[model samples]
Target: MNNKRRVTVILAMAAIAPLTFTACAGGGAAPASGGDVKSLTVLDSYNNDPDKGILQASIDKCAAKVGVTIERTTVPGKDRMQTVLQRSSSKTLPDVLMLDNPEVKDVAATGALSPLSDYKVDMSAFAGNSLDAVTQDGQVYGLPLPADTLGLFYNADVLAAAGITPPKTWDELKAAAAKLTTGDQYGLAFSAAATYEGAWQFLPFMWTNGGDETKLDSPEVKGALQLYVDLVQSGSASKSVINWNQADVKDQFVAGKAAMMINGPWQIPALAKVPGVKWNTVQIPVNKPGQTPTAPLGGMVWTVPRTGDKAKQAKAAEFVACTGTEDSQMALGKARNTVPTQNGLHQKYVSEVPTMAAFTKQVEDARSRTGKLGKDWPKAATTIYTAVQLALTGGASVDEAFSKAAAG
Candidate 1:
């Protein structure tokens, strides 16, 4: 699975040698003359199987269409930035690079990426948040292939047996979860681990309650944290959430130990394997009746690196463009279990896969994790998850957790 990174570009310039390129065309590196470049080298973090194979199929299709062979390198998700930095310093950066959306701003800030507009890549189809994820200082550095966001995944059989509809508000969710609790199964499952994954899970609750990442110690934010603390304290959620990641939450749900879980579409493939475990998805519940369910956008984007060869870079851009087309998006989405980022294609996608309707609706209200904070987001995300872990583990009260975490 491709885990998203909340990027913080605190690297020294000496570590990743600065590209001495002039920003001649709309803040993008002008493609230099390197005649008849016949092949493209690419870098990405889709080393895991199924995703690796699935992504390569799209690359192969685009490479064949562009009449060029592709030389690709795959790295582990957590190591992708380090790989890029090392490659940048050595001047061995690939012709095309794939970056988690938040990482795009950090990399683009270093002038190592060429703006897609320079190659005339289509910019018409992306949604506002999708476009926002890959843009920095008014220049688009990358194009998202698609987007994913958190949702409430529940056991349809469990909810039906309990005579409960999917929750629409926090109060109802609490009641439903309490009602569903029995034996080893908890009312709900979620990840509150001290990592980016935990922060990703918390965003919907915090943002829906009007909590701003910039104001980490505010009452709105503390109230959201209280909800998690309450869940665990009331035995509706396991105290083990302080250590579980999204995958673990999904496991609990599939094993009949959790009636509901907070996760994203990426879990669809795994959930589908167990035919007996009937499941359905709904938008994450709101804190109150009229509030929208806001979630953090998840996924990576394709970018063209400043390889000092305009011809190869432009051709690479064409391949990047190919990957974002509606057909290409849907193909990869179905194969990898993600939602399309294009505004118009979302309806088409949901109509074809009815299970994704709630996810598609939630994406409209979703914001990029780094949208407001930019490269500094990783710092804030770390604090957010630290507080989540602190509160859930009873290491500190909700207010104390946020205050102490933010203090550091």
Candidate 2:
């Protein structure tokens, strides 16, 4: 999440970028013998509580079902990839690893991960976009336990007071935002920092406007950039957005400094705790009346690293498989306030958690950040966020932001 670690991951990943899946003969090494081989070393970024407990509970349940003990190492998200790379080079990678969806393909391309299919991990139940994030060259490498995307979160009371409904189109959004701007509270809040979080937040606008990641300097992208710039320049949004992350944006909304924000379902649990802060969500507004919003799919997927020992790998795969079962996915998604990645469970999940209906619909047509460019997506993500920072901070005009940022 920090710039240093992000750049480190980008550089470290290139060291093992070979695209191969040839399993080592005789499975390299074995764990312990017989009954001794009942535990597995796992790595993940569930360092924060409630989420950490939820993930561990599911993992504990799965480990029991699979007849194994889990020895999990919780790391901060910014350090997980660094730890993975260090352990990888030492041939001591964890038996099971949790990776951000985009990083799944990057690590897989390095041939440092085992194919889930090799261990009979059923891949049929996952959503198409969620599955695509972990697949490369026809090999399925990981299973996404939950999938998420951004939507418009609005304060119901504020909207009612302003006599404004949630916007349905870009023009409506701009008008509503302008009308909502009042004393000490801006109409909207969103991240536009020079980080991947910023790029993640911008996807709906960029994609819904017919922008392409492959063409970063296109008119559509500039138009999307202009939307954010206009909001900030008009004082409908704060200039501090150039430094805010999604968390900060949420905080602004909770404090009533912003009436609307673009965020994902994962924040629901926290939002619920703020007494009487009634809120509701809608799909991200489209650029035009006929256009559909397409947001970037987001989640951390479970993977089995190439730990050499076939037996451990198999057990790890079973553990990974267990985490993705419909029951586990639903339980974890509910506890963590996220959407299940299994397509068949969408209706059931929404029925049980009606607040997530908007997100479920968005996830149905969501796009993977790495789907088009695979491992090369990081570079494009950097370009996107840099352009966003520049445009939002007045460092460059919307028409020049992409070209200038791309040149850098």
Candidate 3:
């Protein structure tokens, strides 16, 4: 699934009424000893094809390696978290669970997940940022698979035709976007919806400019916000961005309404189908030459939940570990169009999928949305998108937008 779907699922899950837990319930029951585990229950939200099929192949391989039969339950992304919460309350949590990276903390905080350390799952191969998302109180709760992050996807044909090059800095982006804008087409397109997806899209610009989520109303943030304001005001980007999700932005890019777009690798499959468009991706531009483009990390993590059955839990951990192995990572990454979380695989992965070079580089330094704020990230994400909407729609000036949104 795309990060937009991941964000929407998280936000939807957050809206549900909070559930309280007793020490025994929250901390998970003591593991029962001595039982043969034949089948393990697994739950995740890969309900669509390609993702669904690709994930199933991995699961089947892992299950065979772990000597267990899998009873997997797939739900729509929007409903997975809610289902997890419901199951948690009823003491029927799946033996294995898959959570979006950011949601790991919230679920782990509730003691619904077991630390991977408990099973001595080896994590040395995974990327630090990917591990950071699933770590709570210094304990890792899950294993991340190949991940995705945002990038600047441009129509190479469009850029060549306009005598333009892919932008490398914010100033150049603004100029290129303006130069590309003409009748019925904008120079650039991006999601600025009043949702976490918008907050996510803005992160590269915000972080590259030295803005922090904890301090959203500062000069650095203002500069980032002003880029959005300027794009809309100068007619280089659609005013309709405030209503567009990432999918809508991709549609705009695919339909020739946008010369370039800010999106992620999850859109690759659909873009591949449109063979006529000569598209390519680059890391989102930095504000200045020295700044590193820091995009938000995107992907789900496979976690072993606190199911109270030691045998099942042990088998589940083995399964999760198998999924993180080098062979599994490469296979899944290739099949799903994502980057492997394993370290030292960059050169090999890039050599295999040349078009993913920019994204591979981006994920190397990508930051997790919940890395600093943990469960409180949803609130900060809300503040960000609210600010974007206000600034882009003239509800407030760029300088005033974050402050006003924070106040509400």
Error (Å) of candidate 1 at residue 234 is 0.2
Query: Candidate 2, residues 1-408: lDDT per residue as tens digits?
Result: 999999999887875564333433335554553344689988899999988998999999999999988898999999988998998887888989999999988899999998999998888888788988899889999989788899999999999999999999988899999999999999999998888999999999999898999999899888899999889999999999989999999999999999999999888878988977899999999887788889999889999987767878888888888888889999988887678998899999999989889999998889999999998998898999999988877789899999898888
- Candidate 1 C-alpha lDDT tens digits along 1-408: 233322223344444554433333234444456787678998999998878999999889888878889999999999999999998886778989999998999899899999998988888888889988788888888989777899999999999999999998999889988988899999999999888999989999999999999999899899899889888899999989989999999999999999999999988878989999999999999887788999999998999998777788888998888888887899887777678888888778888888889998898789898788888999999999999988888788887998788777
Task: Score residue 35 of candidate 3 by CA lDDT.
Answer: 81
Local lDDT at 81 for model 3: 87
The clash tally of candidate 1 reads 0
Per-prediction TM-score to the true structure, in the order listed? 0.90, 0.91, 0.92
Inter-residue clash pairs, candidate 1: none
Pick the winner on TM-score between candidates 2 and 3. 3
Question: What is the RMSD of candidate 3?
Answer: 11.5
lDDT of 3 at 350: 91
Q: Output the better candidate (1/3) by lDDT.
A: 3
C-alpha RMSD values across all candidates: 11.5, 11.0, 11.5
List runs of model 1 lying over 4 Å from the truth. 1-33
Local distance difference test, each candidate: 0.88, 0.89, 0.92
lDDT of 2: 0.89
Error of 1 at 219 (Å): 1.8
Clashing residue pairs for model 2? none
Q: What is the clash count of model 3?
A: 0
